[model samples]
Target: RFGDKFIRVSFSIPTPEVERFVDAFPKVMAEL
Candidate 1:
């Protein structure tokens, strides 16, 4: 899923952004 790409990028992003991304990750994975 596209979530994989986001996961890969999430680590390279800033902490705040990664936190937000992590927060949303569960919902995204659930949707998949």
Candidate 2:
């Protein structure tokens, strides 16, 4: 039960690195 809860929280967490990567992707592609 505890492990399942941890997994849920992990998936729920928003990661800034991912957000930054996503935000930069379009500019990088546009330059190509």
Candidate 3:
């Protein structure tokens, strides 16, 4: 899904909405 460099950059500080979206993403993905 992500390259090494992308993975490294992905962990930078996330906004509150981003954090909430990330929290729900796994559940959404699992349902699909």
Q: Best by lDDT, which number?
A: 1
Candidates arranged by lDDT, highest first: 1, 2, 3
RMSD of model 2 against the true structure: 9.6
User: Residue by residue across 1-32, what tens digits does model 3's lDDT show?
Assistant: 45575455556646775677678978988999
**In candidate 2, what are the lDDT values of residues 1-32, reduced to their tens digit?**
96697567656768785566568868988999
| Model number with the top TM-score | 1
Deviation (Å) of 32 in candidate 2? 0.5
Model 2 ranges with Cα > 4 A deviation: 1-14
- Each candidate's number of clashing pairs is 0, 0, 0
TM-score of each: 0.63, 0.53, 0.56
Candidate 1, RMSD to the unseen true structure: 2.9
Say what the RMSD of model 3 is.
Answer: 3.5
* Residue 13, candidate 2: alpha-carbon lDDT: 61
Q: How accurate is candidate 3 locally (lDDT)?
A: 0.68
Candidate 1, position 16, lDDT: 98
Weakest 10 consecutive residues of candidate 1 by summed lDDT: 2-11
